[model samples]
Target chain A: MDRASRGLPLLISRLDKDYAGKAGPRPVLRGIDLEVEAGAFITLIGPSGCGKSTILRLVAGLDRDYSGSIRVGEAPIRGPDLSRGMLFQEHRLFPWLTVRQNVALGAFHCGLAPAAVDALVRELLERVGLAHAADLFPSQLSGGMAQRASIARTLAGQPRLLLLDEPFSALDAFNRLALQLELERLWQRTGITMILVSHDIEEAAYLSDRIVVLEADPGRIRTVVENPLPRPRDRVSPAFNAIKARLFEALHVDTGAPFAVPTDPAPEEAIP
Target chain B: MSMEVSSGGLAPPGAAEAPRAVPSRAGTLSHPANWRRAASHVASVVAPVALPLLLLGLVASAWEAMAVALHSPLVPHLPEIGKELARIFRGGHFFGEMAVTLLRVGAGFTIAFAVAVAAGIAMGRQKTVAHFLEPAIIVGLTVPGLVWALLCVIWFGIGLTGAAVAVALSIAPALLLNILQGVRAVDAELLEVAAMLRLPLRKRLACLWLPSLMPALLGGARLGLSLAWKVVVLVELFGLSSGIGYQLNSEFGAQNVAGVIAWTLGFAAVMGVLEYGVLAQLEHHLMRWRRTAQV
Candidate 1:
């Protein structure tokens, strides 16, 4: 798709954030710096309270009370814009609206004619496999279906960058795996600069082009691991396991725990 | 990128088909289980109306027995009140009076709703607005409907304006409180989503704020309407020359027990229709999404 080339590179420098605690200003994020190339898939994986989601929120411009330089392409984000879309842990579909109406909200500012907007909504619903459930309210949908609709809503604006804050953490294993695959496919097709915050090691290994591991207690990036596995990575492949093993080592280094070597078992044994 | 992996175990096969196969037509009614289901549905629908009517019947019978035994002029027989009620319906004068009263109620309630919503939203959204309005709202809540009616009658004189203003003043504070609570309780997460999407203010109000406030709006309407009805009648009784309230006042002056009872019952019936027939149906339709959530 030609839109694949529309992704805008993001730059963040010297980012510092603080929260007003009872004692004094508590540092949440400190001296964070990262540069993401256009159309790259990046995952921020870390333990809880490591400020991964906070970073995503900052990049989305939902919270601007931070000392940093965050630029999408060449423009500094003043507030949320149509060019950047975000998905939360919860589906966040408006409970009062049907799937179609909720998705249409994303395109409300696109200045399209009503008919064109309708067609675009239908196309997005179809792409998300929610065409059958388009008229269903958020309450009626299963967890996975609701999240799919949310993805459709996020994609409706054709954003050049997408931020996901553990978008599938609430789902069952089966649904999580399904959505992960769906997200990977969407990333490949749209080539949107994507950033996901997750603590799931395998999830980070499976989807990220680069995983930025973070440490808590005045949160900052510990290391960035570049994935060597090719597209359509097999879960049981030796290379895939190696990358997962490397991520485990990086994560465990902060906790002062010895990294357990991953036992390379047969594919049949790995299926469990 | 493989489609095969996601296609399985996402949505169970035939899950969507189950709701489609529901037997909605009479063709499937002949089945025994379907027959039982239909009977149960009918029973549930009828039970609420049936129980109230049964109690009313018993009360009426007891009143009639007592009236006959006493044989007093003060306690008219049940049949006499029923005859008076029928006459009020048949006589065209009563219809005109009822219509005048209904128009006043409509005007007053509309004014109250508009003012309450405006003030409620302001108070709910801004801390300073809420602080400034809180004491006045509390005082408004404490004042009786009778005082408002009498004050409006004194100020506006014997006219539609007196009755309508009385009703609005008496009811606005309660409705404002209801709407304030709803606005304050709006989900913050959904709002963040609205912000992240860059939804315009107008769209946010329509899709998010208004729908989120609907239950409270409807609840306020129900309470406000009931209060407005009583206040409008009180204002009309003392000040206005034409209305159901005026007729009841005249009946009281004449010491006609049956006439007063008939007018009271007739007004109650109209109020019931407005509440159940109009407001209840609207609430059901607007809140259908919430009902589906429970299932």
Candidate 2:
């Protein structure tokens, strides 16, 4: 057997989750198998109640009652750890805390010196374009700005892998694009593995190197498509359109229009 | 919507002008200043005597009118009551009585607040604790101030200890209920977020649960303080020899209507001062994070 820590950032096999519903123990996820390479960007695209979030929570070590074997590097996650950070859909910033103070909590368990923590918080706020709002409380922030502050807080922990659970779902299109670009830049700069759960097909295509499409009713992966498009991929480009169309088809969305052919298209019908 | 309305109001009344034209900005400059001037004029007329002061004045006049209409010596006029109050203060009987009552209330309140918080936090966080205390808290809530006062007099035999015990027992349940509700109302999402962040138990309690439960705690403290006074007075009237309640009892027995009204007024004045000077200020300082409605 290969050692767990050899270059693989994450591995999961036969993952299953059952929720105690009013009727009975309802199955939410079943027979999931996935492997994440180090520094890879993977997006789990699924409909509501498809258990994409459940998977993210499981990997983030927030949920432990699942029947899955998940390994992060050499370690099996038993509970939330400092090395794996997760961001929820809501900003969830502590209302009593100022922006800087909220971000400061990210590295609280790291035992860094006070000066170092302050410096880290300042740097993260500056990176997220919220340095000016550092002294303001969460209630004083706009929605987009609060989300950016949340992102800064998450990143301050210096997690080796970041799990984002529909982090941009509540944002407007303009703010969404800006955040997506910011996230991509951060990912590229940090070279940290990221697994994002999202229903936005275009977002999955735009930010991720690989997209895992999940089907509902005992949510399981239906397809995993690798995007061959290069970085800074234009949303309107033929290559981007083709990849998006193929994803739509995998997710069973009928675009009702044919996509423009890519100049260098894959011969396979899909990359699964 | 308001922003759109204000911007529309700021627009120049010209069909040919662009929406973002500089001429429109110049035309709009004086509009808000004029509106501000009108608002200030109205505020200047009404702001000096706000609703609370008006209501207080109304209540005072009504109280005086009722005393005159009733034609009973017991229902003293406001001026007569005020005169008795001044006499009591001038004779130096007021401070000692006030001191005795305050000490009992302060001691009782401190004990109740401390125990209720510890017990409330336990009940809020643990099912077993809540299950054990639920029946007792319910019973306590229903029991009256007079009942606790009588029970304390019987058990401890009519002293400061008895008065303090009665006050604590009578008021603890209110604080407990408020604290428990506050703890339960804390956002579940924030708890999950704290767990994901792997905050230490101490940090979680201090930063998350405590802050979330603050409004309830402070509210309970405010109510508990007022209730403690009432219970202490009842206990003192029934048993003790030296407090404001004892003074009221003596005055009532002597049929000195002005004296009874004077002691009652003194108690009210103390409560009002404490509420305004201490509790209200504490609440404003602690809950400064809360946003108030704007006009």
Candidate 3:
């Protein structure tokens, strides 16, 4: 297949990033390669600071200072644009804004009229099934509702690419499952390309067409597994657990002391 | 660091809070929760008027007891002070004098509020500017108001210019501090959203700064107003031909204690009303949205 003949959008070639600190230069990521072509959910899973987030940031145009070039239609990435929206790990909803206002905030730089902004906010809120909580402030909302509002906020710009960075990590088990279902439904309805970064192997297996696993110690791609699991993904399904168990074993876990919060009595030297 | 009470019990923030079913307020006046809030609001207004009246009563009874003890005609009784208050309120010269003093204080206050808030916003945005302004604001805050009066008198002479300068010098430090704090206290995320949108100052001020600055700004304004008045009165006492401060001076010199008390009580009442009515109303209106913004 002549991939160029299809005009399939992707970030081609290796991505490199170096951390320049006051003390000295410390290299974080090197020789990273990824391909996210049209309308696909790409999951990048790894332990913390594996530069999985750095990759997403590079694609989103949030980080441009790097050794490699990211060619978006022959133009170098300059700054954040309306073509992409990102969801941070924390909901990051504006405390001063109601759910509706927080969602509308995404449309602020999009140059949309007030009526159109309102309509988009309403539509996204309804799609996320959080229309009932639209009037509530972010502080008044529950963990799930806040994340729903965050999703709505990201979607308000009508971006071609959605970057989700462990958005449902803060939720409980049941709520995370519901949010995953909601996200799947949203992607189905919108046909938007999403590159999600998560540490949860099951979540990646359930949601992504393919999972790209990166190993720790200045991370690099370790595995790319095509998840052939059927939709309406059930956690109790035999094949589902089989895939989950396999991914879980393959997961580096990196419980290497640093991942554990203090008060666990882990040896300090065992970390990073 | 602090405990917040929910319907069921106390809980810290950043915890999962489930909504609980609870009955309505017990009664409009009898409800322990909002009733206390309502009563406090009423008391803030009522206390200003009641305290002075009761204070005058107690002072009068003491003065009467002292008059009898000393056999001296110096200390005036409650009735004498009431008569003096009646005279001051009705007398065109005294009322006219208060109006003049108020004009000077008001002018200085408006200028101080404008400069302080603008400086605060500018400083908040630029670290370099804040670095320079920090030392100056601290100096102003620590310097005595009397020194400002003396300096202004030398610079502007003993007139409205001198009076206005005195008042501004007295309040500029405090006003600057509050305005800076308001700007500093504004949520960084909200500011980020505003910047991302490229919002204009008016929109930013209306939608962001006004709500964010209300409590601090109002608090600053109240202090500025009171401090300005004191500065104005002190200037008038030292230099002006006519004002409440002048009246107090003349009354004290003539041993008319009743007249001096009358002027002091009258000035304190005016301060109370300005605080409760003008400044507090602005605070309430500006922070109305904030009341329900977060849990």
Best by DockQ: 1
Model 1, runs deviating above 4 Å: A1-4, A253-272, B1-3, B6-38, B65-71, B292-295
| lDDT of candidate 2 at residue A255, scale 0 to 100 | 75
- For B76-145, candidate 3 gives per-residue lDDT tens digits of 6667878998998884766687788888898888888888989999998899999999999989988888
RMSD of each: 4.0, 7.3, 9.2
Per-residue C-alpha lDDT of model 1 across residues B191-251, encoded as one tens digit per residue: 8999988888999889999999999999999999889888888888889888888899999
Ranking by DockQ: 1, 2, 3
Report the lDDT tens digits of candidate 2 across residue range B1-295: 0011112111111122112212332334369876786788888888755866888789989989999899798788888878888989996789988999999998899889888888988998899999999998999999999999999999999677888889899999999999989988999889988887789999998889889988998899888987998888888899889999899999889998989978987888788888888888988887776656655
What is the C-alpha local distance difference test score of each model? Answer: 0.86, 0.83, 0.74
What docking grade applies to model 3? incorrect
Query: Across residues A10-37, which tens digit of lDDT does each residue of candidate 2 receive?
Result: 9999999999999999999999999998
Q: By the TM-score metric, which is better: model 1 or model 3?
A: 1
Against the hidden reference, what TM-scores do the models get?
A: 0.91, 0.88, 0.76
Candidate 3 per-residue lDDT, tens place, A1-272, comes to 23222222457467668888888876677777777776787799988878888887777776678877676545667776666677877887766667898788778778899999999898877766677677877666777777777877877766767778888898987677766766776666556777899988878978988888887556678877667665756665656655665565567443434333232212323322
Clash count for candidate 3 is: 0
